[model samples]
Target: MNRKTLVLPAVIGLLAPVLAACGGSDDGGRAGGAITVGTTDSYTASKEAPAPLDPAYAYDAGSWNLLRQTLQTLMTMPRGGGEPVPEAAKECGFTDSGNERYECTLRDGLKFASGDAITATDVKYSIDRVLGIKASTGVSGLLSTVDTIETQGYKKVIFHLRTPDATFPYKLATPVAGIVHPEEYPRDKLRTGFKVDGSGPYTLRAEVKGDTIAKAVFTKNDRYTGQLTPKNNSIELRPFADADAMGAALDKGDIDLMTRTMTPAQVEKLSSATTGDVKLTATPGLEIRYLGFNTEAPVVRDKAVRQAMAQIIDRGQLASTVYGEMAEPLFSLVPANITGHSNAFFNKYGAPSADKARQILSKAGVTTPVRLTLNYTTDHYGSGTKKEFEVLKTQLDRSGLFKVEIKGTKWTDFRADGLDGKYAVYGLGWFPDFPDADNFLAPFLDEGNFLALPYVNSAIRDDLIPQSRREADRLIASDSIEEIQNIVADDVPVLPLWQGKQYVAARDDIQGVEWALDSSSNLQLWELSRGVSG
Candidate 1:
C-alpha cells in the first residue's frame, strides 16, 4: 500500500511570516494562488518514524509523489501513463540483446532549479548514489541488475547490467532515478534535512524553524524544460487526521482536491449526492489485497492446511458485503487487465466448499479442528478490515474442520511485526512500484523478498521468475506468470483476495480529474487545475 499521506510538520507555523512577506493569502486553502491538497499522514512514514525527503532514502508513497513533482527523472510516466517517456533525457533505449546494456543521451542546455548545468555525469552520479546508499526500504532493488555505469563525454550515459532486466527503463521513470545537482548532493551519504535541487516541473521550499523543519512548499520550476507543465502555479500538500476530516474539508472547499484517503462509502456518498459540490473520478488500480501465509509457522506451514483455507474462503461475498462494488474478486495474485493474469485459484478450487476443504485435509492426514490465527491491521488497510476479517473467521469456523482466532494490530506495529514473523497468517495489500507482472511477483515470491514470509518455492524462485524477466515479449512472459500463479494456487503460499478500484474526489470546478491518476495509480497533482470545470 502507498504510505499514508504526510501531514505538514509542526514547523509549518514558521512559514507564515515568510509566506506573508511574499504577500500570500491568510487562508491555508489558497497560498499565493496555489492549489491546496489535503490527505492523511497515515502512510507517509514507516511504523518506526517520520519519512525522509531525500529521493535516495524516501520509500513511502507521500514522499515519492512529492519527489516526482520536484525531481525530474530521465524518463517519466506521462499524463495518460503507459510506457515511460523521455523527461530530462533526449532519448533512452537498450543497446544490447537480453536488455543487458541500456543507453541514454542527456538533453542539451538542461539546468537544475539552482542553475547548475545538467550533464551525463550527473545522471551516472544520481544512479550510482542510489546503488551506493542502498537504503533497505528505498528503490535501490529496482536497479539490482545494474553492474556498472559508464559516461561518454557530456551527453551520453550507458548502463551495463549483470543480468537482463527489461523493466530497467521503467525503474528510471520512478523517483529513485531523479537526477540531482551532484555538487549540491553528497556522493557518500543521503542529503537529508529538507532542501531539494531538482529539474522536475516543481521545486520544494523547506526551511528550519527553530528546532523543527517547516512544511515543504512546492512551486513551479520555471527552469524545467521537461514535457510536464504545471497546471497550478503552486501546490501545498497537507495531511488530515482521517478520511472523514478530509471529506469535510473538501465539501467546505478548504481543499481543492483530496487524493488517496477517501473511503468507499465516501465515494458512494459523493457520487450519489446531487449536491454538485464534489466530483468522483475512478482510475484503474493494480492494488491487490491478499492473505499471506508464513510457511515457518507450525499451524499454517502445512501445504494442505493452507490449501484448505484457500478453498473455503468466499471472495465474491467479501467483495459485495465488505467492499461493496469498490472491489472485484481476485482469483490470481496478479491483478486483472495485466498480462499473465489467470483465474488459477478459481479454476483450481471452483467454489467455496467445506466438503472439498475437509477432503483435502483428510487426504493429507491432517486432523480436524486445525487451530489457526488470522491477523490483520486495524488502521492502515481501511475501515472495512474488521468486517472483512470477521467474514473470514466466520467462513473458516463454519467449515468445522478449523478453529480460527482473529487478531488485529495498528498499521505501524503490524508492519514491523509482520516482517519479524509475529503472525502466522496475516493480511497484506500491494500497491505496485511499477506496472508490470514482475512487480507483483518479485516482491512477494523472490528469494530474500520483502514479504518476509519463508515461502521459497524452488521452481518459482529459481526458474520461472528469472526466465520471465529475460523474455522481452510481454505475451511470452505472461506464460511464466500463468505457470507461477498455478504454482501459487496449488501451493497456497498466499490467498488471493480482492483487487480494488482507484477513486479521486475533487470539487466540480477541478479540471484534469481524468488525468489525475496515472496508469500506475500514483496520484498526479500536476494534472490538477482550478478555474476550469472537469
Candidate 2:
C-alpha cells in the first residue's frame, strides 16, 4: 500500500469555519439516505494497477478500499481487528498437521449479487485466475505457496500447498483471495471496465472520467450472503484531486464524511472547538514510510555509503517537524505495535550524528562531498512531501559530507521508474496486507522483492522467512522476526523513517467511525451510517 499525502496550510482557507449539520436522514435507528464519503486518493489504469475493480488485478489500498465493499473473500478480519473469521465460508482451517493442506465449506445458500449461487467451483476459479494472470503489480506473490486447488463438491474446496505455511488463512482473508464469478471473470485475463460481480455487502456502480474515477455509487446488495450487514441504504464515494478540495466539501456538507487522505493541517483544525459539528477520530495505525536504496546504483551500492547515510538521518526530526503528532520515529522494518518489533537501527547507529557518519565514510576510504539524487512522488503522498524532502535535504547537506539533489515525480511514473532502477534512492510507504510481522519484512527483503531492488541476503531470504512461516503461532516466531530486523539494520538496503497514525475526520453524527477501518487500515464503507446525536 502507498502512503497518503497531506496538503499545505495555505489550502486551509478553503474550509468553512464550521461544518454544517449532518446531511443524511435517520431511519429506523439507521441512516435512511446515502452517505457521501470523500477521499483525495486517485487511481489510474497503469501497470501498477491495470484494473481497479477486478479482484485479479487491484493491489493498492485505494483499489482494495473499494473492492472490499463488493468482493467477499473466503475469510475476513473482524470489525475492530483479529484473526480471520468465516464470511462466505461456513468454516475453514488446516486439515493437515504440516499446514500444507487447507479446506473450506461454503455457507449454505450463498449467492452473488447477480443471483447466481456461489459454490466451491467459483472459489477455485477465482484463485486459479489470479495465479494464471500473474499481473506484475497484483498480489499473486501472496499465494505463491499454493500448489493446486481442488473442489470436492458444490460446497467444499481444498487447497494443497507446496510448502508448510501457517499464514495461509491470513492470505485468504485479503481481497486478493476474493471469489469471482467464473463466467464474468476470465481464467487467464483481467476483467475489463469498472463493473464488479461478487457476494459482498455492497454493489458498485462507478462513474469514470478519462483515466481516473470521479465517483463510485454503492447500493446495499440485499442478495448478498455474508457476515456483515449494511448500516446505510447506499454510499457515494467521491474522489478529489487533493485534500483541500475534500476538506472544503466536508465543511459545506457536499460530503457527509472525509477519510483516507486528510492533510495534517486540516486534521489539527478539525480538532478545535470552533469546528463543533466535526469529529476527529484517531486510531492505532500500522502504516510506515521509509527510504529504499537501489543497491546497484553506483553512489548507493557501497555498503559503507548506505550505512553512513543511515547514520546521518534523524528520524525523530522527520517525525516531529514534518508529520507533527501524526507519526513517530521508526527504527525497525516492523512497526512498534507488531509483535517481534526491535529497535535494531537505534541499537546499531545510536542517535543521528554527522561526526559518526564522517568517521564511517573516512574509514571506508570514501571522499567527502559525495553527491546523490533523492527521488520522491510529487502527487501521491500529499503536498507535505515537498517540505519533508526539503527537510531531508537540509539534514544531509548541513553535514558537509554529502551533496544531495532531490527530484519529485507523479506516483505512477515514480513507481515505474523505481522498478526500472532509474533512481538511486527513493521514498516508499507500506500498508500491511495483514497484521503480521511477516507481511512487513518478507515483502521487501525476500528474493524478488516487490521493490525491484537488487539487494539480497541469503540468511534472510533463504532461512529466516521460511522458518517464521512454519510456525502457526506468530508469537513463537518472534526470535526469527527480530533477527530479520537485525540483518536489515546491518545491510541498510532500506532505511526506516517513521510510522504513521490513522486519522479519520467525519461529521459528529457519523456512527461506527472507530470500527470502519480494519487492522491493515483498509476502509470498510459498510460500517458507516448516520446516527442521531444524543
Q: Which residue pairs overlap in candidate 2's backbone?
A: 5-381, 5-382, 6-382
- Per-residue lDDT for 519 in model 2? 51
lDDT of 1: 0.76
lDDT by candidate, in order shown: 0.76, 0.82
Clashing pairs in 1: 3-43, 4-42, 4-43, 4-44, 5-41
The C-alpha stretches of model 1 lying farther than 4 A from their native spots are 1-32, 41-52, 181-197, 205-216, 532-534
Cα lDDT of model 2 by residue, 256-283, tens digit: 7887777778867765445356677666
After TM-score superposition, the amount by which residue 349's alpha carbon in candidate 2 deviates from its true location, in angstroms, is 0.6
Question: How does residue 120 of candidate 2 score in lDDT?
Answer: 95
The Cα error of candidate 1 at residue 384, in Å, is 2.2
